[model samples]
Target chain A: MTGDTHYDLEILAELAEGLLDDATARRVREHLAVCDPCGESLADLAAVREMLAAVPVPAMPLGVAMRIDRALADEPNPFASVPVGANGLSKLSLVPALDASAEVDSEELATVTPIRRGRRVWVATLGMAAAAAGVFGASVLASSLMSAPGGTLAEPPATSVSTPERSPQRTLAYTVRASGHNYTSRELSGPLVGYFGPEPGTGSNNDEQLDACVQDKANELDRPPIAVDRAQYNGSEATVMAFWEDQSLDKVRVVVVDDNCRELRQDGLATWN
Target chain B: MTPPPEQPATPEHSAVAGARASVTDADLLARHIGGDPQAFSEIVKRHRDRMWAVALRTLGDPDEAADAVQDAFMSAYRKADSFRGDAAVTTWLHRIVVNACLDRMRRKSVRPVADDELIEAAERDTQLPDQTAEREVSMEVTAALKLLPSDQRAALVLVDMMGYSVEDAASVLGVPAGTVKSRCARGRAKLAPILSHLRNRTDLTRVSSAKGAELRDG
Candidate 1:
């Protein structure tokens, strides 16, 4: 089988790049010593690699830098004012529920209500500790806005992009079936550790498209999601799921996405190191 | 007294915020975790440029790179508690930024763009005509780079363009040094044919310029 076949570009490149084992390199070089085309190809590849190295990395534009600065400034911190470590991670508490509230109705999934976590959820200044878990939600007003007619929202209204001829449940395609039970705002909690978005056909979740979308998100996250459920996050319809940021750590990242697979929640829970 | 004017910044406060430059990266991270409002901001100011460079080179799209870099800083801010101090802070940032790019790439599905289209795109840029030579070569390189797979592009960018040693890049990428070398090798091989025109163009320009210089001297 070891006839007169020329080595592929990658193999020849490996030899030139010093990646091949000594024995293989010797073999390739022996062939190259006799073959002019292979030799020329190797030289050209080396020159190309050199050209790639010649271009310098450009600096981040000033506008982009300022944008990132503003982003970091918005991180949630609970211990900003009190002396550092005075109130440790466990000691950090939510300020009294201000004017906001998170109300969930059990039966008929009725009663669209206002929801609020705590003022600390809105603050900067952190106490670095194990981020046990965050049942992350989208905009605080998502649920209220979904339930109320003609309500103005910071985000555009959630209008399903699917036409009527398409599957009526196409709006549910990106989210795995929720076992036929809709989740209220309060049902989501605890650590995020699971294979992916509610086992595909647990109760009524056999929607193949939903399964496919969830799997796509899993690949993007590099980890299977814990739950991809049809739920009212705050008051908005969303697919809430958890992804492992770094499994070695004790926390997981939770995100909320709408029907179009766009992440609805721009804000995420923060933990200090 | 107008609610006592909300407590003023103590001299103690000025020292911490003012000493941002002198503070070590790890100390700044620690300060951020401790609720120092300005510590994380200072960290971003210091490392964002290098990280932005890495992201832009790996992704080849400024808009995507900007989003990836922003995502990296935000993730790092949230995951500040996860840093174990086993690596340099820059290494940590690189890993976060690289992973963010990978995520975006996976979501967007990278595809190759033809060289002519890219060159046309470059000509449309509003840069001064005097800058055309450098800008043209840059566009050529960028277009050729877009032909590579994301993993190969990332390894090539870190090792060849940004000057990270293969071993160091492997640490940031959480892969073996051997893997980085092979990826770079394969990426270079793939790019060779596509980029060969550049080598020919350089040779031609050099020959023409030398002839012109000789004429001037005569």
Candidate 2:
């Protein structure tokens, strides 16, 4: 060992960690036998490592396991019984309607079925509807009184629906449901084809008649509807649309009305609650 | 038809259970891919605690660690069919958990721990009259760990804290063995001053001396 020479701190540190090649480690050890400073540095590094090794392995938090279970339960098992389409949308049979006398609220039951379907695509339906409904209580069923005077689709605001102050419990329940069912951006378009008729036009209808129908619906509902369109609900011709009452994406108003400008029943449409 | 009466456990059932208990991780993963519903859950139950330990030490926050571990297992479950079997299942899990933790840290921009908060954490642990000396030391080590760069901390956590070999740590980090070694060296250098107090404690010093001797002889 050279009496005047000391190894670099990195080399000594590596030696301390036992990370050097056997030959390099031997050289460093021989130097350490004669060099107090290098030996002391190695000793200090070893102590640091030992102290770190002593840190407790904390028990996994209880909530983490519960959250994982919920997440896993919600996850669509690729190998499970559910059939998935080529586009990744699961083909779920329409959930059987719940008994009328069951304790489950219709809206709550409405929220539960799609979730059970385990289809990432369908989750967006409730999420979008819950977002549009905002603080409004039970969806107001609006149906178009009739087609425009000439049997053409009516203008925007076709029928009026009112926003009732919904209980906080309902809002929280819906919010919790929505948060659990996340949809991919691609799945957002799937709901459009299913709820609205093929190719629903964008940005508040350019057709004056459609605009008038939307205006009529907004005035009646007392909430402005966005993306108003002449659409179909379950093979029945209807006007389908959504509106936002607040800046939050969660606060949105959605309305579906029959061709005659009357409210549609909640059960008739798959996307609305 | 009435349901058949329940049968008591038989030698055949016990033999089946014994055989199943010896199934390898890869076999379990294969079973999951082949549509066995219980296999993946068994895998999760087996390795979750160790995965949690690696994540918690790497992230230094229980909430974030929990989130990372949960994400890792979910990803593992989803992509079980993709396992090429090139590495051990634990190694693959380590990679996933580490990546998840790093992704989370990157998303948050990993704000530096404020000096006051570090002081507060240290004071809080030390102030408890009933706190054991070992617990105090553990807390101190954890606090010191938070001071290192995330990558170095991860390497040190995997190798030093979790008792993984440097080569295994390299595989998990997706870095070379040399890189792992360098990171460990640098991390230990940085932690030395912070953990200096433990150097004087007889219990730790003796343990450290033995460990040092082992490393030197190796």
Candidate 3:
């Protein structure tokens, strides 16, 4: 029984996270239906989450941004040397070199531009010094390699320290699966209502048909439909809670299907308030 | 010269264009690549305050939130070229800010503070004039938010607090929309109970509905 209690927590966390497959989520839901302790734990954790959300964020300090601007001023563009991936970290290559001592002078811009455009500006004049440094550094590295008696000349150049070329950014796709002992709450009716984009007015509201589609998807995954408990029907939104086979935050997708059913929302866990 | 016949624009046409013009995070990013550092600044200005609020709410420390917001904007700028315009700018920015806060949390190894402790502290901090009551209400609600785990807190902040749709929030968090829906529901359910309790407390009750109207009118 003790072990089973622990097992229930494991199931609840997975269910809450929406990471479980359809069949697994279903089994957990069935268990939750019969298990009072597990159900209570889930609710308690959920309440805790809600309370934590009310915390306030303070106003941003003026100094941090000034520092960032200063850092950018002296930081040579990382793109000048390294490449980046669409989905990987880029632009940040120059960030590590951001020393607090770097001055944010307008003069640095005038000096730095000449090197890229090959103008005979003071900054370009300093390029000779940098080029010399590069040559000297390369020679030192080459000498160290050559001094190794068994070093292979045919070895490929070390590109490990260099950044890669830029590529298009990749969009992540997420899947949602829900299952639980069916409870009736008004908040759980209709299609899954989800928000999309930066602006609030741009998101979509699901009609009853969309709810049917969501239920159909759930059934297709072998999980029972989310049953409605009560509905406080407002003009556009109906607030209700439902008995899901499992209750996880991550097991839903909210999209604005165009007339052609083209999805317009980023794929991920949809929030409903 | 006669004006061209004024085309009657249908709502559908307007909707499509509106959606298109709403600029994705990737679009802003592409503009940054064209040597307009200001484009990056635009993105920063657009989401910086919201990102800061997210950090402050999750961490409950203004100084930590400041560092988090700066780091998030810098991270987004560095990774601007990687953006593909797949999600809204706000959502992507939220993800960056949340991730930065989480990273800070990991480094500091912090946990959520007790509810009563935070409530007591929040009560002490509620000192604004009655005329500015709405702002105080918002601040009060914000205090309870500090008790949630970072992930759920981020979800609730985007949904209930900021009023983002579940789908848009999912896009911002880079998760399935269904997951956002569940979290929003769970978050609201949890918040409703505590808020109901706070609604009865004397300090919070001081800001009446009439005061709320007065603040709005002012």
Candidate 4:
């Protein structure tokens, strides 16, 4: 027999195990019908396979199955949690149910709620610190004014104006509301409006490309998001709103900017629930 | 409250169909994405046994096997969305189980037994109950399997015995389907001669039993 006929044994093996695709299996079956040697080999493989099946599965030790069930129980849903890489991510193999769906129940949601609340608490705490510093400086201005001989303390200029009410690093609850239009639209909440701050770039801010990333973080954190109304922002700029669970007045910041990086309008509301 | 009686997994009243009815892997996954935690249970029930078997064979220790199976399933759950559904569900599960088993093996400090030693050990371990009716058959199969390489043994076990398709077996072994076929072929060739001898012994047993019965009657 030619070497090729001998090599066909591999295909026959797969065929014996029911692994061959229909086309491949058909070809192998045709060959087996005519080739007595291959047929006998196939028959032997089949018999051994049957015998192996007849041998009973070894009994698993006690509590082993229950322990497996428990491990499976603890496995978190990948969709609800984080995406692990293919190389060594333990999450990928264990939690099949978690991957299929995204609908979280209220109690399951409770586990995540603290994380959300913690984020809000941290953000609000930073905002409060900023406000407290402002208040202390304002008090000093009042003392200086009372000491003036003309008895006129110029109204302490509101520091809230012109100064963007956002710190550079305060983690904002940034959400992107995008729709297909002539111009891409985006919404900003928390601290950013005019630009995402200079990262040594020469040109204008590219919020259009950045919207996808912002939305990704939103999905990762499982924060409740307001619908990005597609109908309202057909073209031009889309209004961005960041929701802070802490009802601090200076918490929300909205920046409407044009394509050329000019700020069209900026509004910062520190209190948002 | 009285605990539920320990019933066989496949019960007459609560059939595999009913047990399967609550959720399937795909359904649980879909529900899990929507955030239902209970859906995870279905995935566990569906794959735990097969996962355990793969781990037990690959790792060879009960504790390690249990850990590997758990880790494999948990890892699969964590990456459920990444599963593109290109492979069959079984293949995907096997891939996870095999990876976990291999990982467990790698983490161990001790070296695995050499093939000759393993064969000897296995033969010694499976020593037949001398008087049992099934002894001869068990002895022959065990002896034959002991001679095959561990990889070939696993291939035969999964493909020939357990009835996984070649594609599924290959996916489990992380090898080519062609390799699986070759292994299966070699495995059978190695087993055939041994089985022929076993058949001869069986015939001898039948004849001897017949003679002894006649003597007793006479």
Candidate 5:
């Protein structure tokens, strides 16, 4: 205490900050009203607080920020990514998600990480198609295009079986490959003709034996199948169903599922520009 | 305004990132859970500077501050789904970063490797534009803060420097509001005489306290 007659800095500081009890703060205020040094000490403490508040915040170093970015990018998938890439889901493991798999070799299964599960192939393709079509471009580009099942993937280009996983830097590689089918029209009958064989027996939902599979496909797409035809996709007896995604009817998603509702990977269709 | 975009960030990725710039922090965390790979990164990009400031102010060193911030983000990334969302995301984040800083301070205090941080801090990292004044202020601030204990330093940084309310500071520091208030008060009393010379305020008399003499000689 200055002069052995006034309160020390701590009491005065607490009084200044209103941290003291009302009775003690009143006594300190009365003492400070009669004493000059104690008042000066109190004012100086306030200045210190002001100085702290005035201190400018330093900018985060760019190098440090970039380092954080690298560390984040290298982080492996932490948890589940629900819509697609969910573990143990129905994904085409061996067959590439693309229509042109002529170069597919046996080793393609070991090296390529099927993170996409081939289920969102049509979804991501539709998203990118929306970008190309420029109809619902902005919202579709950010939302559906972004979450469009593996719209961006690092696995091997399933479109070309011989390519092998070229670039391993997830998100930036093969995000939007050229669509193999336009999917603009609903006429998959010609390509799916082989599924019905030489004499197509009135193939309009006539496959009463595969009624459950067709309904499962319908339930998955949230709509009734527009056209269901029998096919041997990837050497398995499969049902190829074309789904009209929305009321706009500008987009069509084709799903190839076997006797079970599991989606099968079928890659081999001509280009549709 | 954009801080002059960095390199290796592709135009398409930049555009996509820009499109998602308006996403709320909670939504970004949710999207990360929903399997959007870029969602978490956007969260990082949005909050790095704020967390960096809190970490740097608490640790008073750049390298350690960087590590603490990294640790906090990595922890947050792994624990995104577990966030209960009761508090503001910034509050939860500052808690992580401040906890990281306090942990580092505790470990550093216990370990033999001391004073090396001060020597290395002299080397200076990067020179940000218009950072001269801020650097000087932080240097003085750091020196003054080193006089106090780490708890007091954390409380003062949040309450005074960051303008956090006492309750918010207490929340970030995981302490009672009374504890935060008392720390700030005791810290200010000790800092008043020492920082008067550093800040050179006009209205204050320069009384030489024991703490002031110690700081002056050191």
Candidate 6:
């Protein structure tokens, strides 16, 4: 067997798929006639392709069609609706519907409100402390701001709080906790509460008001969040909520704040931790 | 604007006639753009099944696939004016759906759930009793496909399963033809071992032994 002249797998795969040019295919065919191993390999690849092609095409689900109809009905001419500025560029405000499409239901949003209100207070307090502490506090404040909504926070929230737990040298003065796990930081409180229900210490009246607001917002939007939880972002903790449709996690919303509840950052569709 | 009042023919008859007519997809798109609302609906009715199939195989999660298809069609509706007419409407739609699936896959990778959860979800979707064996094999293939990198899996799905030509698959993938070819080859090479058990040919042992020897030598 002329095993010395074995073609690359890519070439053989292309030959099997009839993707190669005529000359190259002819050459591969000639080689395959003498090369038993190569021939078998080609046959195996061909079988794999056959099996893949045979994978059944499922019928379109009824829900998808209905959703599409509803969406189209709501926006008959999406292109025409795009507002144009003086420069002729489209001035598209962030559509709430687009955001709603990512979430599960109104209950998640309801859970997120109290947590957000609490975080805002803490962030405001932290912002003042950071301001008084000068550059170091400024850096923390900047990080805090970045973690807020509409701020350009790309990295996961876990990075800020997770490091102290993983690395011994970076001991934090304050305690940082999430999903029941605790880590200590010397600079601030370790407890980062991402509450789904009423905020602790808040009265039932306040809870009722928050729930009303959530319901109103939900009524306005077609889609709402599936679940909401508290998560720590950067050094600040926020109410982290997720919108899931069907079984997939569609979007995450983070309401980040500093320890003083002064520095507020609210973001929708943030990456899930 | 409303469509003109129809004659006393049945709806099914009209739909069948519509299907038989030589109205191109582009024609339907143009009609929709020109305010014929039913044109886009017709397009959706014709292609929704195939689009679902592509999304399902690519995503391996029925719920996610449905969401992806919804997103794709909505995007298509909104961006219909952006259609350049260089490719068939089906190809353009497939590209959008594939992209949506990839985006979901990327997000899922960033925050992966448990394997048990995934298997359970797949089982819930394929709960029919008559096709249990077929469903099992499909699930196995899907699980194996998930093990491959996203790009390789996309390439394999487009070319191998969906039967797109190499050039067309490359176009949809926005990669060079050579890259698509390599991705397919590498993807198949990985899948061969995983799927070998499904092959019942008499020459299986011989082929595997030859593959082993080749691996040892090379």
All candidates' lDDT scores? 0.55, 0.55, 0.42, 0.45, 0.54, 0.51
lDDT of 5 at B77: 87
The CA lDDT at B98 in model 2 is 94
- Score chain B of each candidate by TM-score: 0.77, 0.80, 0.65, 0.62, 0.74, 0.77
What tens-digit string does per-residue lDDT give for candidate 4 at B128-150?
A: 33444345565457556656766
Error of 5 at A240 (Å): 53
Question: Over the stretch B84-183, how does candidate 3's per-residue lDDT look in tens digits?
Answer: 5655566667778878887887798765566575545444322222444444455556665555556666787666555566677777777887777566
Candidate 4, A230: how far from true, in Å? 54
Off by over 4 Å in 1: A1-5, A78-273, B1-21, B111-131, B203-218
Candidate of highest TM-score: 2
lDDT (Cα, tens digit) per residue for candidate 1, span A16-54: 567778888778777776666666666667666666666
* TM-score of candidate 3 on Cα atoms, chains taken together: 0.40
lDDT tens digits, residues A5-44, model 2? 8876677788766677899889888877777777677778
RMSD in angstroms between candidate 5 and the native structure over all alpha carbons: 20.4
Model 1, residue A111: what's the lDDT? 24
Better of 1 and 2 by DockQ: 2
TM-score of each: 0.52, 0.54, 0.40, 0.41, 0.53, 0.49
Error of 1 at A242 (Å): 50
Tell me the TM-score of model 4: 0.41
Predicted structure 4: lDDT: 0.45
Cα RMSD to native, each candidate?
20.8, 19.3, 26.0, 25.8, 20.4, 19.5
